[model samples]
Target: MASRDLVTGKIFSLQTIVGILGNFSVLYFYLFLHYTRCKLRSTDCNLKNLTVANLLVIFSKGVPKMMAGFGLKDFINDFGCKFFFYVHRVGRDVSIGTTCLLSVFQAIAISPLNSRWAELKVKAHKYIATSNIFCWILNMMLNIILPLYVTDKRNNTNFTQKTDYGYCYVMEDGTVTMKIYAALILCRDGFSLVLIVSASSFTVFILHRHKQQVRYIHRNNLSPRSSPESTATQSILVLLCTFVSLWTLSSIFLICLTVLNNLSLWLRNTSALINACFPTVSPYILINYDSRVPRVCFA
Candidate 1:
């Protein structure tokens, strides 16, 4: 128990600090770089959207759990619990949606100069901006129902029949109804997953074709023009792959947590931490790839 608690505390501390610094660095770069240029790329706007969602996630999920690790578990009220999970769900959904938008936008932006998508690339900024707004509105509405089912453990301590997860309480009014809600949430997430896979597939296909063309041109001239678009696309690909892997692993662990009987507190907390790990991991990917961030740290 001591070792588990020690590990959990250290991990939580690491995640919170890394997430704050990394996401904040991304935000700062966008501010300075975009403001100085007095222009924003479509990808930059989408990156800002993603960074903001991740910051929301870190604040909502990471901070509370960090506090929990430090033995401040009773600080949250019922409303706090509901609000935490609500924000957590919204941030996660928005992150997925923004990633899909980024992939789709990049695929459009990097289309062949003569292709139909090239025309859309000229107007990519408007499309990306509109999509970010739509993602925020859509995710907010999709997760609004979350608070109804989640509450603080204080409320549950009075009820002997309640199910508590150390930090929060789930008041299961009806098993069937909860199952239906879970299915709906899963379906929503599944739809987002499909969008990401489709967009990523399209991006990959376009990049492959572009690379072949570049190779042919380079063979002729013995010089290749590297594309800013391709470099950015590579970064997005890393972000997409990392997010999907973390989300998938977290989902698998979640499924097991539900199916297994009398799960240990360490297992339960670790699974929840895994779900929060993506935000911490993703910001660093963006920062490492982005040119605007100072090069000295990476060096």
Candidate 2:
């Protein structure tokens, strides 16, 4: 094996291990809360769904990359390639949608009574399940076309019309129809990103306003410590920042890979690493910010 491949394999192996453990920790903590009849917040549902989506991304994207890195590139057949690619695309889209949903809900939850979002605040929690279900359905439908375009690399002899994804071959002709389809996919992702940014901005404004109101209390030595609301707000803000940053980086890598007619193994490895970064790091953010997680762990 090449030295570069060995290094990539080790790195992916670590990411796969850490991401799985962290996400499962979050899932286990939430499941424990549920089985124990612990009081759950409305946002907990979103967190759980997000964790599941992260797991899906890790298993479908990260695991395959790891296997490829370890010289198992030819292990996957046409069916496996299609299945993994399809699941990864669906999982990634769902993750973005869930994050957007969570951000909007947080903004609504913090809205002032006289604000335009007040009405949403009262009914937001009620729609969490419905919203999550819709997100899954929408993404699944959107990415159903992936399987048709993906096949095992070993089985394909054509090099002029296919892009190698290490373990799978993506049939791309750069035709007008394919370009239009790609544009539509970009539009869908762009819409989700816009919503996320707007919701996050609104949440930041509300938090800032609340902080200003509470400044006087702290100044008067009334309440020296921060409120639980403040902590939760900080968590959401950090989560949004982390997601946006990683999402931007991953998108760049993905676009670079997609537009290139030839496959560069280095670019492919780097892209896979960037794509897995959010899932690997996000669970740690949640674990650190959520006060209840430690309690459940100790219990």
Candidate 3:
């Protein structure tokens, strides 16, 4: 019942509610598009998966943090802690995985027909579904160990309960096995980061060239109404930039929180808050990105 917890709780509670509403609203748009279309486009397919990934993030991480904020400090037990962290890690990892996929797929979608990437577009549909399944498998396998390390902090005297957010981390064993496992996890995330950046960069490169081509044809007199491709590219660029900025900030702070033992609690909450904002904002971006979709569909 500390004053700080009360304040933090209220703020995160508001964040969680906003996240749910925003993501679900986007979900509705996707669902409507799915049933109405004769066939689903690769972008829509990737986005549908992204919607699920973001929702998983909200349900997995946001809800627990919100509960903890509402003074449910000890509401969770050992099993509950295990379940919460398990789902949270899986959801967190999957969100990043899906983002990487979305970036790559969109990049491929916009690639020139003669380009090597465009050749893969034919298989993009199948590749996306298969990749989605692979992503889920990889995330679940990698993060299943998270719950093993997490337990109810109240019952354990040896490990310090983290006060930054809802979950507690098990004390590091310092054994070679634990060290290797840590490295492996870092490598997984590192690869995901590299993919995200590379994909975003390539997308922007292609889009820039595309814009130049259009400019040459129109003599720099572009139409007020944007083409679907143009709108999609702009949307992807904004989404990728926003995602990378937030992801980098959260990753840096979370690593610091884990490595530095003397950091204050406020910093930890700040990191969690950053992590929570991405899911909420991303859905709105997706919904508003294309003026053609919902308006045309509902009309």
Mind giving the per-residue lDDT tens digits that candidate 3 earns over 5-70?
788888888888888888887777777766667455567766777778777777767777777766
Ranking by TM-score: 2, 3, 1
Model 2 lDDT tens row, 96-161: 999999988888888898987778779889999999999999989878877988889777366458
Q: Please provide, for model 1 over 246-296, each residue's C-alpha lDDT reduced to its tens digit, 9 standing for 90 to 100.
A: 989988988887677567888878787887788888888987776546642
Candidate 2 total steric clashes: 0
TM-score of each: 0.88, 0.96, 0.91
The alpha-carbon lDDT assigned to residue 17 of candidate 1 equals 91
Instruction: Give model 1's TM-score versus the native structure.
Output: 0.88
In candidate 2, list every pair of residues with a backbone clash. Answer: none
At residue 239, candidate 1 shows an lDDT of 91
Stretches of candidate 2 exceeding 4 Å from the true structure: 175-177
Note the residue pairs that clash in candidate 1: none
| 2 against 3, candidate with superior lDDT | 2
**Which prediction has more favorable TM-score, 1 or 3?**
3
What lDDT does each candidate get? 0.79, 0.87, 0.77
Which segments of model 3 are wrong by more than 4 Å? Answer: 160-169, 220-222, 296-299
